[model samples]
Structure formats: C-alpha cells, structure tokens
Target: MIRALALAVALACPGTALAQAGLDALDRRSELLGWEAVGRLDMPHGTCTATLIAADVVLTAAHCLHGLDADAPVRFRAGLSHGRAVSERQLAGWVMPERYRTDRGALERTESVGLDVALGRLDAPISTTDADPFLVLTDEARGDALSVVSYGRGRLDAPSRQGTCRIRQRFTHEVLGFDCDVTFGSSGAPVFARQGRRMRILSVVSAGDGVRAFGPRVAGRIAPLQAALDRDVPAPASTTGIKRLRVGEGRAGASGARFVRPERSP
Candidate 1:
C-alpha cells in the first residue's frame, strides 16, 4: 500500500539512526516475512518477514504473494535471526483480496481493498518463547504509534548480514506516517504496535520509496484487506509445546544453502 505525502524532508535526518534501529529489531525481535519457494515452479521457496497475528496465522503484504500461483508453498519464519531460525511453519492456505493488483503506474497506488494485506494459515504452531503472535488493530489504536520491520538488502544507511529496518510512525484509520525508507524485500513485513507485554499487528508493509520517491499510500489500501483476512482466518487452533528450536542452526549443513542471519537495527 503506497500513498503520496508532503515532499518536505525532515530537518534531523535519522537515516543512520533509523538504520541502526532496523538492525536492532532483527537481532532482538521475532519478526516474520512472507517467503516463497525459489528455483523450480514446484520447488518455489524464498523468505520475507511478517508478524504473527494468530497462533497459526500471519499477516503480511498481499504483493508478496501476488505472482505466486495458488499451489505455491508459502512459509513464515518467526523470531528469525542470522539464519539461525526460531520457528518455521508451512502455510496451509493464503488469502489476498482481489483489489491488490498493480495499477501499472510509475507512482504505484495500492488499495487496502485487496493488494495491501494478506493472511496465511500455518501448517503447524509457533512457540511464544522468543516468538509469539501479535494482537489485532482496535479503534483506540487509530492514532497510535506503529513500527515497520523488514529484511531486505536495499539502500540501508548501514548494511548488516541480518538485513533489517524499522521506522516509527503514527497510524490513523486511513494512514500511517514517518520517514519513508524501505526496499523490495520488505514487502510483507508487519506494521506493529507493542503495548506493555503484548505486541499487536496494525498493518503489513505495503510500499515506501521504490526508486525515486519516499513513502507511498498504504493506509486506505490495507485496512479493508485486513478486514477480509479476519473473516477468512478466523482464529488459530491452540497447540501446546510448539518447538522452540531454530530451523537452520543444525540443518543448513545438510540443506547446502548458506544460512543468513537476521540483523538487528537500533
């Protein structure tokens, strides 16, 4: 979800500070992204980060799964760090509204009606130890703070092996705002809110600066999309004793793929 905002840049450029925050987030938090199977059409696998909304459900940006066919194997990795892992769950099903399609413009416009959000039902459960699900949006949260965390190798002020970033902003029923800075790999990262000991999900990463712009419109685009998700996913089934071990720590050697660690931002 992308929106046009005032072009005035902030006087205090926190590009470096903001980048550090992103890095810190990756190291310390359990952020999940929407990943796809790469390589073969049948063997597709890739990774994106997202927020756990239900015991077995994740909220992410719809574009992350846009080109993905219906039968694609979608996975969500929560509490991901340095490719070491935390939890891995295969998606039983995915839902994206019909409105999330591209509008084919230089300044892309996405609608919460469809393209701004997506929901996934995990094949298994995730532990709440280092990883847990977040709460959903509420009316009181309409003008509160939010965070966007992601793993991508874009124009980060400082680079890290973990590849993470987070920007603080305020959310309205129709918009979320802060300094815009994100890249392609960040598509499905969660826009979250932490209250006391509980973290809630408000939106999924939609769009920010692509090539030449800053934040794009994402508010009106994702709200309706999220509403649709709530209707489809309902709630996740409770599963006790979900495994707390990371996936790639001991298995990457056998898998032959180099494990990448998620970086933390300040």
Candidate 2:
C-alpha cells in the first residue's frame, strides 16, 4: 500500500523526483503514523507546511498568514500523500503573538523570531486515529539533533523527511538555528525531537536564508498561546492571504527557499 502511494505521488508530481530521492517519503499509513498529524496548509495566497499540536489546533509560522484579510479560507490537509490524505479540515480561526509583525523590514531583526509562531483552531475536532497530535517540548533545544518533515515546493504531493538535521546555534532563549534542508513552502514545518517512541515538536521552520533555517523555540511561548487559543472563538473569516512569487520570477531570498526546478523535455 505504501509503495503504491509512493508510486502514485511520483507520477503525479514529477517535479519532486530529484528532491524526493534525497529525502525519505512518508508513503504509507504505517510509515506516517508518527507524523500523520503533520500536513500542509493551502492558503489562498500560497502553501505553507503545518502540524497538529492538538486535535483541534494547528501550529505554523505567523508569516505564512501575514498581511492578508482576516477572513480568508485556509484548508488543512492532514497526512497528505499523492491524492490521498488521512483527513482534511478547514480552519475556523487563528492567532499570532502581538509581537510578531509582518512588515518588510521585520524579517531582518533578531527579535522577529519571538513573533514567528502562530496557532489555528479547526472548525471541528479531528479523529485521533487519522493522526495523533504532537506534544511541545518545553525545554530549550540547543545542540540537539533534530528532524524535519515538510511539504516543500515541488515536493508538495507528499511530506519528505530529513531525519537527521541538527541545531547549530541557539541565538536566544526564544530562537534556534538549524542546519536543516528547507525551501519555499517549508515555512511553518515542524522541527522535531524524538524521545523514546514519541516525537515532540521543538520549534517551527520560519526562514531559510540560504545559509541556515531559523525556527521559534517552543519553550515559553506554547503554554500561553495554547491557553489563549482555548479561550478564543473562531473568527468570522480569515482576511489574510499569502502572495507568492514563482521561482525565477524574482529574487528568492525573501520567500524562504531558492530551489531550482528540474528541466523537462517536450
């Protein structure tokens, strides 16, 4: 079943072949059991990766939904592989820290890391059997070897796993730097730490500035955010939408990943 799904994905998304070869594909339900909650968010503006930290809540990067109408629609496809998925849900509301600003200049500042995180509330609760939500690791994640599974550009058909990335720097208590391989559409992807048989979410992929990837540490921010989300009601609609520039259409640094698509023969 897993191989069939993988073959289906490979055929549907021919562009992902080269990149997929280097990363492990969570092709079967069994292979995806640990990460079934991690999925892709298809926003009106663009696509960003996301993960379920709670059955009704999703964690992603604030910038992924920045500067759009507050009433836009964002669809979450859980455990998406090829044309199949474990489940799907439409978000009802979302919240980002007040400190996380989306102004063009904000990305350059170190303080921006503190505001990069965001949480979305689902309209309905998802079944645990489809995908189990991950627990947030409250401790600082310095010098730890981590893994990232993301639905990046080109490889959007299925999630790809980079099972052995490392945290190279801890900029502050709130921010950590990693040597993970990420690209456009990878924004909001979870950086995970495997503990025994369980996987815990440590941080979220925020930016890949061509050198290293940066994610907001989950240490102190998660509890409060989770509390706020619990009390917060669903918004009438989502007003924000992401505007994405296609590869080679403009300079790529601002968008996150600078990936080169393979050439095709007619």
Candidate 3:
C-alpha cells in the first residue's frame, strides 16, 4: 500500500517577535513552509485556525463552522502574534460541505479523513498589513517532508502570547503519519512547501491527539476544490490596485520562499 504521510503546516502570528521566531525556525526549512494568517471560528466550544488562500478568501476546517448555521457571524483575526490582534477581519460569507453536521462521532472520523474543508470570503480583500503574500500548493505525487507553524498556548506557552510550532511528523503522501504534537486549537493551519521558486500548499492541519497521528489527507481530492476556488469563487480588487506587489527593493529574492522582514500594515 502507498503509505502516505500528511504534513500539517501551521499558521503564524505577524509581529516582530513572532516573525523573528518563525524566521529563525524557518531558515532550515524555509522551502517547506511560510507565514500564514490563521483565525478561529469563535464558538462556545473553542476556536479553529484559518489560512489565506486567495486575496479575500480563507481556507479552514469545515468542523469549525459545523455548530453554527449559515447566517452565523464569522469573525477572523490575522497577524496572531500577540494574544490577539486589534485589526482582524469579519467575513461576509462562510461555506462548507452540506454533509457536515455538529454531531460527535461523525465529526471525529470525518474531520481527519474526510473532506473537512471550509472557505470564507472576507468583507473586502484582506489588507497586506495583516496577511502577506500567498503560499503555493503541493501536488499528490510530491514527496512527504512538511513543516507546521502555530500561534497559541502550547503545553508550556514558550512563546508567551505569540505563535509557536514544531516539526510535527515526517511521512509519505499515499499514507499519512504525524507526531501528534498538535491539538484542537491548532486546526486550520496550512500545510505547504516550496519547490524551486513556488510556495505550494498541500494540506491544512485538521485534528489529532497530543502525541502522534496523521493529518488530513489532501491528494486526489484537492483538484475539484482548486477548480472551485479558481472558477467559482470571486475576489475583490487589490488595495494596491495591481495584480501583484512589486516588493521593489528591500524584499529578498522572489524564489517563492518564505522570508522574514519588518512587519507592515495594509
């Protein structure tokens, strides 16, 4: 059997300290991950992390919205380095698969193995100030070495009100494997990598125990989702009014690699 190991790339906070921590930890694995905006869905139970896939779009776990109906207000926070952010965004709409429900047993099995994905369209294009350049996605046939990042209260709270992540696991794609260091609040962090000059996102961290487990698999199923994102979803015009940022001078080489510089506001 093809032993596929799913990698869970975590989301990050966007302050000087968080950025520095990410940069420091990223130097060795820069090609595998980048800084992303992960927000919680805000429910009585808990919260979930989210990542930006498009200009005004975020990709999170469907379970995050499972408890609420379609009309529920979906709030999001980017740059999650400090305990929270003052400049978070509120979404206009939240969409997920119709099959999902707020039940217990179904949620557990469906969360890790099923298509537990969700999408949110922001009220406007999220400012680059809070979010940053986009990350890429990995194909099914690619190798299985991933890096996860997160900003939340860990077992010890080393970062202190900032984001912290560790190398969770290492396995193949056809069969997934993980170290299970992630927890409930860590859900929705993007799993990605950089091949040559492209930042390819493979899977989003869904769920696992506190020890060692696999992340949600994302190989053959992502095609339809990618199609939906590219063809069906619409994004607002850029604040800069340009297709892409120039990043003219001070910014490092554009190898689609994740780098750390002074944080800026949108």
Q: Give the top-scoring candidate (TM-score).
A: 2
Sorted on lDDT, highest at the top, how do the candidates line up? 2, 3, 1
**Cα lDDT of model 3 by residue, 100-190, tens digit:** 4344335334333355666776666665545564543544524334444443334111111112233344444322444324444556555
**Residue 109 displacement (Å), model 2:** 1.5
lDDT of 1 at 69: 69
The residue-by-residue lDDT of candidate 1 on 97-148, one tens digit each, is: 5644444123223223123456666676665443444545453454344445
Ranking by TM-score: 2, 3, 1
CA lDDT for candidate 2: 0.68
Tens digit of lDDT per residue, candidate 2, span 1-266?
Answer: 22322232222111111233346767766667667888999998788889987667889887777675667999999999997889898888787776564453444344465567888887776665566677776665555558888998777898888777788766643677777877777788899875544457888887654446777786567667766766785423332331221111322344322121221222
Off by over 4 Å in 2: 1-22, 101-108, 234-266
For model 3 the TM-score comes to 0.61
TM-score against truth, every candidate: 0.57, 0.76, 0.61
Predicted structure 3: lDDT: 0.46
